[model samples]
Target: MNKEVKELDLIIIGAGPAGLTAAIYASRAKLNMLLIEDAIVGGQVRSSYTIENYPGFKKVEGGTLADLMQEQAQELGAEIDEFDMVERVQFSDSEKIVETSSYIYKPKAVIISTGAVPRKLPIANEEKYAGKGVHYCAVCDGAMYEGKTVGVVGGGNSALEEALFLSRFAEKVILVRRYDYFKGEKATLDEVLNHPKIEVMYNWDLVDVNGAEFMEKAKIKNTLTGEEKEIVMDAVFGYIGTEPKTKLFKDYINLNPQGYILTDENMRTNIKGVYGAGDVREKAFRQITTAVADGTISALDAEKYIVESKRVK
Candidate 1:
């Protein structure tokens, strides 16, 4: 364990939109803050192809948008460390200690914006052919399957949205859903139903993926009739749901039933000095705009806490 003590007024875990936004706010306020991210700076946004929904910009590449945010934060005096993975966080009324794989941090406050991981299929060989043929973000890998047939699994909004995105590149998109009914909005359902290249296969659960190097075929079991069948496809995408990245905080922070961190409106967690934000926190929506809002709130709260602590000292 590295013994170098890197102390700051606040530490924001994750360099995604939320974390970076927090860094911007804290740094702009002249608060001594640090932003840490073990993964890529932009989080899931970097994997996206073209993001049109984000404010200000009509259309921008995901990677480009992340770069802009990162640059802005750093220019505002936010220190971003991309090497360490925060493994544990110990909170107290006076100070908060964050332990990562490489170093330990004792910041006045911590903002946990670790984000969430995509839920994957439990099928065999799914991990083996991850990038080869198995994909999660359609916007990230849809171009790879240009004119090729692809399989999409899910019954919710994410699945349907990705299927629509995939339809632009793939000649045929097979929608394999475990339930007969779609759980997405009516507008999306109508669009999917009217799509010519999309074949909606309802009540089907993906069981296995057959591929030597990449994906070639997939085996799915029908939930209603208990029938199984194999279909050929160049690639498969899973978007069932997301598991919040809160394993480290489970024993410490308060979480909801699905393991998402529980935070109040101010982004304050059960602990006073520790705050939750972005997708990692339980909220109604998980979008870039909302994440930015969460980060802003967390940073402001951290700044206020630090000022009060100084007064108490």
Candidate 2:
């Protein structure tokens, strides 16, 4: 039997800050809409232990902020469907079809806010030791290394934050950075530097990992002097960077060399009646505030397009 087919004014593809923000606006506009998420509603924001930069809040947990966003959207009458994976999409100027595991949606406008995924470490046996010793989310795997030693790779906000979070569980946290200076916020960098449990390795790169069953040693080399050293750790957490999660829409959308969707200032992709927002789009910066802004612009643009198209019809 065929799946149920429902039509609406718009369909938001992600429930992160971007998609949630769009849903809030769309609901206020009284547009028939649905927000779908394959994973948790909060997206990457849930991973953060503490967030202080977001406006209006002095300090808040990432999960709490996400919950507030989700609450606001729902209160605004936005219909959200969680854990429904979109299987396929067909976009055009007149109509767009989105197919998921449970239903098939035919919406007049579609917003893509799938966001990005963590970049993996490019070291030997990294895949073999993925779950055993190599992990991307310290929040999820840090508890597993209780009273043990773990190494964190990267020099950005995520690396610094994860190191602090891991320090609570690991007896010692080795933060490995290839650059001489950290690139994250000054406050976060300062905290990591001052934390006694965390050891910051400047101008050093993790070249390899060695072990039989689980990871035993991480081989790091000094970038300036070419000196190498091995640190014995139970696990390695990588936060080098992230790549766009555009695999589902890559063939249909115009993407840059780095695989981020290319969009105009209005958040309109090359395809009409379709839009890209948040970390999934090609932008200089990726932040919760920026993603919210992107979602607002796209939803408004999409609403206008739908109204104009109705007149034309």
Model 2 regions lying over 4 Å from their true place: none
- Please tell me which predicted candidate would have the highest TM-score against the true structure: 2
The worst-scoring run of ten residues by lDDT in candidate 2 lies at 88-97
Local accuracy of candidate 1 as per-residue lDDT tens digits, 1-313: 4567778789899888999999999999999888889888988888766676789999898899999999999999999988678877788666688887676789989999999989978888877989998889888789999999999998887788788889999999999988889888788789898999999987888998887778899988989989998899899999878999988888779999999999999999888889998999999888899999999999998899989887987
Clashing pairs in 2: none
Which parts of model 1 are misplaced by more than 4 Å?
Answer: 185-191
Q: Please, what is the TM-score per model?
A: 0.90, 0.96
Look at candidate 1 and give me any clashing residue pairs: none
Question: lDDT of each prediction vs. the true structure?
Answer: 0.89, 0.92
